[model samples]
Target: MTLFEAERVEKVFPGVRALDGVNLSLEPGSVHALLGENGAGKSTLIKVITGLYRPDGGRLLLDGQQVSFGSPHESASAGIGVVHQERNLIPGFTVGENILLQQLPTSRGLVDRTAIRSEAARWLAELDLELDPDLPVTELSVAQAQLVEIAKALSIESRVLLLDEPTASITPSEAERLFRVVGKLKDQGCAVLFVSHKLEEVFEICDTVTVLRDGASVLEGGPLSDLTRDEVVDLMVGRVHEALVLPPRTVDTTAEPLLELSGLSTATGHDGVDLAVRPGEIVGLYGLVGAGRSELAKALLGLDRITAGEVRVRGAAVRIRNVRDALKNHKIGYVSENRKEEGVFLEQSVGRNIAVTVWDRLRAGIGRLPVLRYVPKRAEADLVSDYVEHLGIRIASPAQLAGTLSGGNQQKVSLAKWLAAQTEILIIDEPTVGIDVRTKDAFHTLIWDLAANGLAILLITSDLPEMITLADRVVVMRDHRVRGEVVNSRDYDTMSQRVIRLIHAEPAPAA
Candidate 1:
């Protein structure tokens, strides 16, 4: 039975038809996938279905009855729940409070604290999460927070559930756990809508898939088993995307290292780490979620205090006390993993955000009679326009807010900021997170292009395939310590197995 259906839905925004004649049907006990490239109306359809937006045409039907939801709350009250990609939890609230916020148990006209905690615990346990109910939401890691969000959504016991990029921030094990929970929900006859950029995950979890492209349904609902991955990709992007293969390394390995960390110990628990990236080399730091990959990146960027270690740039020792020092003195750039929080300023224009790092160079005059220093608008515009074109950033205009752009475009802006800074050594953390496959391929090409142009890049990521596809060398880390390093043979199976063994603390098999 069709539990929910969207009939000829149409949504229009200023100067953009976000969704045009989009139709969908969600049957009970099935996971329906919504697949598309970035800015292809997937989000618009989700908003329309979840009551964040009302369709301009057609109607929504639930259990064969016409219904209209005025707001998200109204939809939720009608047994619809959503787990957004971006976390929507109150940081200061406890786990129990956050999970039971919508419908807290009451005793004598008062919020029942014990009952709430117990109920929250049960829900979390159902998802195989063993978190403390009293723990604050802010104290949890990104993966944990995601799990809590899932628990919160599941706590409502809704018949129709919507999960947007649920596994984007989680580790493989955690993602498996989520898949199991989703399976349980499906077994219970719950209708699930799964949206993801990862095609492998979509194939693993979805029963049926609908592909949207350019605000229209290019491929209507069909069993995923009936379609090939290439066909799905073609429908999503309107073109066949070639498989990403790591190009031959052209870096001079004999040259002095651009950035080297020797016996690095950070106050944040990173200990005795050693790594190096020479000019024209892309070194990948491969690790699991808690393997200290991000922490090491922070230590290199001076965002976290390094208790003991020697950081060398071109064989010269330097103390990077802060991010500014790392950028200005050592010529090191960092693209943070948490792009939404640490990367581009969301409210600022795309041009301004890209030009921010080069403000000193943008100044027209320095050391003048009155010490006049003014930003040359023409020069800034030229530079921003060059990067915008070179990086293929999709934006209406340079004056548009960075937040208004799609995920892939925002990431390009972040890269443009560092490129404008002209840093010699770049530390990019999870550059492709939340980006579509086509954009990911473009980024991989761009990274190699930058490396070919003699830029040293330290790529920090939890994605093994991405590591193999771009890095010349892979440094495996586990528990804040460097396990081992391997040269990429471009063989995914061998490289992944070695990395997995190292991550699991298994001794490398005798050669």
Candidate 2:
């Protein structure tokens, strides 16, 4: 039986028709996939269904009865729960409080703490999470927070659940745990709408898929067995898709290292780590969750304290005080993995986001006054336009807010700032976590081109295929320490085997 349905939904924002005649249906006891490129109206449709936005045309139905939700709370009350890609948990709130925030139990007009803890614990155990109910949300890791959000959604006892990019930040094992929870939900007659750019995961668990293209449904409710990956790609892109083929480029191994970490130790538990990235080289850091790949990058950028180590740049030892010093003094730039937070400023204009790194250079002041310095609008505009055109960022206008643009475009804006800063060495963490295949290909090509132009890049990602596609050498990390390094042959079978072996290998004994 159909648990929920959207009939020819339409949503318009100003001049842009965000969604046009889109349709979706969720049947009980099945995982239905919602697939699309970034900005293809998937998020918009989700918002319309969850009551963050109301459809301008058509209507929604719950159990064949027409229904409209004025807000997310109303939707949740009606047994519809949604976990958006961006987390909504409040900082400093306990796990139990966050989970039951929608319907907190009260005693004599005061919040019932005991009831909240027990109720939240019951929901958390449903997903096999061993979390303390009183633990603050801020204390959780990214993956933990993601799972907690799902537990919060499930606490509403939703008959219909919408999960957006749930596995984007999680490790493979964590993802499998989520898949198991999804299996249990389906067995319990729950209808699930799963949204993700990871096609393999979608194919593994989804029964039916709906593909969106430019605010319209190109394919709706098609069985996964009936479609090939290529076919789905075509539906999402509206074209006969071609795989990205990068040109052969050679890196000079004899060249001096642009960035070198010798016996680096960080406060975040990294010990005796040694790594190097020479000019025009792409060195990948590949590992499982909690492997300290991103932590190492943070320490390099001075976000985290480096306890003991020698960081040499171009054969000279230097200490980076912060991201600013790394960018301006050392010509090093880092594109953070948490793009929504540390990357592009969502509320700012695209032009400003791209020009942020070069503001110091673009600024002009009165003849002898540094305090009165201001960025020349003309200069900023020119630079922003240059990178926008070069990076092929699709935006209605430069003034469009970064939040309004799609994930892929926002990422381009994030990387554009680094390039604009003329950074010789770049560290990109999980560059294509939740982006579509076509956009991922474009980004890979861009990275390849940058390296070809003599830019040194330190790439961090858990996607082995992505690592093989781009990195010339792969550095394996385990427990915040370097285990081994693999030279990329670009052959998935051989490279993946070596990487996996290194990941599961026993630790070396101390002398």
Candidate 3:
């Protein structure tokens, strides 16, 4: 039976027709996969279906009866739940409070704390998540917080569940757990709408597939078994996406290393780390969560204090006291994994954010005069305009807020900021997280382009395929230390096995 349907939906923004006559159907007991490129109108269609934006035309039908949702609350009340890509939780609230925010148990006109804890625990247990109900939301990791969002959605007991990029930030093991829960929900005849850029995940869990392109439904309601991955890609992109083949490195390894860490120790637990990136080289740091990949990146950027070891930039030892020092003194920059938190200033204009790193250069002044040191707005805009076009960033205008752009475009802006900084050594952590496949391809190309132009890159990622695809040398980290390094031959199986063995091997006994 058709549990829900969007009939001839049309939605438009100021200058863009986000959705044009898009149609979708959700059947009970099936997971429907929505596949598209970054700007293919997938998000807009979801928004229309969930009542975040009422369709400018057509209507939504629930159980064969046409209905309209004025707001998200109305949609939720009508058995629709959404786990958005960006986390939606109150950090000040405890896990229990976040899980049952709408309908908390009450006692004598007051909140029932014990009942709330018990109820929240029950829901979390359903998803096999082991979390303290009393812990503040801020204390949870990105993956854990995503699980809490799922638990919160499940608490609604919605017949129609919408999961957007659910596995983007999670580990393979954690993703398997989520799939098991999704299977359970399918068994219970829930209508699940799954949106993801991970084609493997879609093929693994979804029963039906729908492809959207150019704000229109290009393909609809086909059994997953009937379509090939190549077919889906072609449909979404309107052309065959040639497999990305990274060109041979032009790096001169004998040259002085642009950035090197010798006997590095950080307060966050990484110790005795030894790594180096020469000009035009790409070094991959591959590890699982808690293996200290991000912590090491932080230490490199001086976000964390380094107690031991020496950091050398361009053959000269230096102390990176903070991010400013790393950028200004050492000519090094970092692209944070947590884009929303540390990468982009969401409330600021894209031009402003991109030009921020080059403000000193943009200043038209002599020394020591505050008024004379003012930023030249025209020069900054010209610089930003070039990058916006160079990076293919899709923004209505440079004045548009960074937050208003799509995930892929926002990531491009983040990259643009570092590019504007003109830092010779760049540390990029999880650069493709939450982005689409096409955008990932673009980013990979850009990274290679940067390296080909003699900019050294240090890439930290949990994704094995990405590590193998881009890195010249993969540094395996386990238990907060470098276990070994493998040369990438572009052979996925061999490289992955070697890396996996290093990741799981027991640490050597202290010498």
Candidate 4:
């Protein structure tokens, strides 16, 4: 019997039918893969399953019995746990507190701190995670935070578990740990619904798959052994998601560097980080999860203290006080890898997120009172619509909440905000972490076009394939220091081998 099932489920939003007769079944003691491209109703289906949104039609069966959930808490109480693609941890709370937030222990009507720590620690140890229970959620790295969320779900002791892009921010080594946890969960007869864009991982761990395209199921609960990767891809995107298209463009090596880092030592342990990006150049910062690539970017933006060395912008030594100073004064913008937290405002409307950077320019001043200015609604909508069209962001309206969009669409909006700023220098970290194959390709092309148009780009990505496709030069960083640089040949095997050698302390060919 199916542990849980979405039978002919349909969900509708304003001007969009997010789910149309979508069918999925999760079986006890099996890992089921839910496959779909971005904006293909994957997140929407998960929302419906977890009761973040109620279905417009169809039945949700738990243990072969029809049931309904009015809220996420209700679903959890009914023995379902979920780790959403977007983060759900609250800042300023300890990891232990966040883990047991839904079912906090009480003694004499007060929260039991000791029970929370012991229970949270048990769940963390179950997954082989070594995080301290007392550590604040704000202090955890992206991967650590992701693991904590997983631990939170596991703490529910639910019969069904849903993980949506759980490994997107984590390294392969960490992902292996998650896979092990999934294996144990399956052994315990917990129905696991795994959703990810990484097809290799899905093929490796999943026994059965359900492929969704355009809000409908093309393949429902089929055995993975019967379907090749190509077949799965075709089902997810209908023959349009494979190619990584990049136009040829030559960078002018003679031009002065727009953004240069000279002997850059930071409080975050980055030392002697020398980098340069000239006009129309894509300089890729390639590294492992904790190699300080994101830290280097943060130091450049003045988020971390620059204890030593200089960050030079266009030949002049400068000290960037904050992101605002970096963008408004120096015409530099950064698209953070943690998009849900730092990229776009979740609760705000899509239009507001896209028009944020140019709000100053969009504002109109009253007669002789330049200081008193407000943004006109018409101008903001037109500006947001242009970006939404250019980026191919699928939204019913600009007024829709950004949190409601899929992960890939949210990522596009993040990049669009920087583009709206018209920054000469851009730092994009993990441009397509949770995005699907086709959307990832389109994003790569977009980044390429930006470089071709004379914008200096500093890209930090753990994705080797993406680095090979987009970066003109790949600078390898290991343990917070530059190991070597490779002039990208765009050859996958060759580039992968060179980067692996550099990461492993082997000498690399000159750029």
Question: Poorest 10 consecutive residues of model 1 by lDDT?
Answer: 364-373
lDDT of 2 by residue, 1-511 (tens): 7899999999998667889999999999999999999989998999999999989998999999999999999999999998888778998799999999999999999999999999999988877778999999976766678888998998887999999988887777778888998899999999999999999999999999999999999998999999999999989998878978899999999999999999999999999999999999999998887788988998998888999989999999999999999998999999988778889999999999999998988999988988999999999999999999999898888898998888888889999999999999999998987798899999999999999999999999877889999999999999999999999999999898888889999554466
Give lDDT per model, in order: 0.87, 0.91, 0.88, 0.91
lDDT of 1 by residue, 449-486 (tens): 89999999999876678888899999988878999999
Write down the TM-score for model 1.
0.94
The candidates, ranked best first by lDDT, are 2, 4, 3, 1
Better of 1 and 2 by TM-score: 2
- Candidate 3: where is the Cα deviation over 4 Å? 126-128, 366-369, 506-511
Per model, state how many residue pairs clash: 0, 0, 0, 0
Candidate 1: list runs displaced more than 4 Å. Answer: 106-113, 365-372
Candidate 3 per-residue lDDT, tens place, 101-124, comes to: 868889999999999999999989
Report the C-alpha displacement of residue 288, candidate 1, in angstroms. 1.9
What is the C-alpha local distance difference test score of candidate 3?
A: 0.88
Estimate, for each residue in 160-269, the C-alpha lDDT of model 4 and write its tens digit: 99999998887677788889989989999999999999889999899999999999999999999999988899999888445565667999999999999999999888
Candidate 3: lDDT of 366? 64
Candidate 4 regions with alpha-carbon error over 4 angstroms? 102-119, 240-242, 371-378, 504-511
What clash count does candidate 3 reach?
Answer: 0
Q: What is the lDDT for 430 in model 1?
A: 85
